[model samples]
Target: MKTESLSQLLSFLDASPTPFHAVDALRNRLNAFGFEELLEQESWKIHPGSKYFVVRGDTSIAAWIQGTESPSVTGFRLIGAHTDSPNLRIKPQPDLNQHGYLQFGVEVYGGALLSSWADRDLSLGWNDLPEKQNRKNRRTLFFIILNRF
Candidate 1:
C-alpha cells in the first residue's frame, strides 16, 4: 500500500508542470474522494458532513469538510501546502532577432537556478482565461516542452 501510494505521488508530481496543472490534479483527486467544487462568485449553501473545495487564480485551492461541530466550539482542521516552481513569462513583444536567430523575451518568476537550466530542455506552460472567469476555469491551456538543443 505504501509503495502504491508513493508511486501515485510520483506520478502526480510528474504530471504537474504548472500551478494550474497542480490545482487541477488535486481537484480530480478530491473529486474521486467525493469532494464537490464550489464557486466563490456564487452563494454557498453549506451543509454539515459535506466536503467542498474552491480554487482561486488556478494557483490556490482550498478544501473543507463541514463537520457537525459548530465553529464557536470546535475549530476547523487546516492542512496547507504550496507548490513553488520556476516559471518564465514571455513579454508582450517577445519576438526578437538576435544573431539571425529568433528569440523570445522571457522573465523568470520563481526561485530558479538560471545556471542549472543551461543545456537542459525547458518545459513551458501557459493558460489564457476570460475576463469573466477566474484562472480556475481557464479557457485555453498550452503545455509546451522545448526540444533539447
Candidate 2:
C-alpha cells in the first residue's frame, strides 16, 4: 500500500471506535496501494512479491510488506501497532447505580490518563474474536477533550 505517515495512521485509528472498524478502514486505504486481504480460515501460502494482510475477529490484525523474499529469506519490513484502546469494558450487567450516581467499574490499561476517562469521546478496538465481516469492520469513533475543568 502507499506508505502513510504515522500521524495519518493515528488519525485513522482515532476515527475508529473498534478494532473491527480500524481494520476495515485500513484495508480500504491499502487497496489503493496493492495490498490484498488474506483469509485465516483458508490454508496459507504466499508467493514472492505478494503483500498480504490478515484479520482476527474484531480486534487484532497483522500485515506484512513482502518483497521478493520467502519467509526464510531473513529480511522484511513490518510496522506494528495495536488497534485497541482502553475503556471500562466487561460483560453487560444490570444496575449501574451503586450510590446515588451512575458508576462504572474500571480497570486501567496502558499509558492512559485516568482523569480523562470521563467526558470524552473514545474509539474502540481490541484483540478478541474472529469473523470474516470483522475483517472488514470498524465501529464507533471518539473525540477526546484532553482537558476538562
Candidate 3:
C-alpha cells in the first residue's frame, strides 16, 4: 500500500459527503494505478490479473485487486484494521432551519463514541451491493461495495 495515497484517504473521505462521492474519489485514485472502469450494465468475464469495479446504487461500494493465478486464489495476509469513523450526514430533507445552523444528521454505525464526533472531522467509505426492492426503477445511480483498500 502506498502511504501517501493511504494518508490522503482521510481527507478524501472528509470531502465526500456521500458514499457515491467517496467512490468517485477512489475511482480517480485507482486510475493512477491503471485500473479500468467496468460498465454498470455490462457483463463481466473474470480472469487472472484483471481489476474491475461496479457501483450498485448510491450507498454501497466494492472493488477487487487482481492476482496472477488464473483462479486468483492468492492469499497472503490481511493487515490493518478496517475503520469507519462516525460523522454527520445531511438529512434527506435537511435544511438549515434546525438550530439556526448548518448541520448534518448523523447516525452512529458499528461501535463508536458518538459524542466525540461532535468535535472531529469524519471520513467515510462504502461497501456491499445488496439487491434493491424495486426493479422497475431505472438505475440512474449505482451502489458500490468497497473492495479496494
Q: Which candidate is the best by lDDT?
A: 1
lDDT, model 2, position 28: 71
Candidate 2, 49-146: lDDT as tens digits = 78788877646777877678555677656678887665545434523786688754556555767687567654333344337667454444333333
All candidates: TM-score: 0.82, 0.59, 0.49
Where is model 3 poorest over a 10-residue stretch in terms of lDDT? Answer: 76-85
Error of 2 at 9 (Å): 3.6
Q: Give the TM-score of candidate 2.
A: 0.59
- Candidate 3 ranges beyond 4 A from true positions: 1-18, 72-84, 95-112, 118-149
Instruction: Give me the runs in candidate 1 sitting further than 4 Å from their true place.
Output: 97-100, 130-137
Give the per-residue lDDT digits (tens) of candidate 3, residues 1-149: 69888878778865555555665666666778777766678887766677766555544445676677644465644333222344444446554556677754655455666776556544533333345876534333333343433
What C-alpha RMSD separates each model from the true structure?
2.8, 5.7, 9.0
| Angstrom error at residue 105, model 2 | 7.1
Candidate 2 vs 3: which has more TM-score: 2
Q: With candidate 2 superimposed using the best TM-score fit, by how many Å does residue 21's alpha carbon deviate from the native?
A: 2.0
Give the number of the best model, judged by TM-score. 1
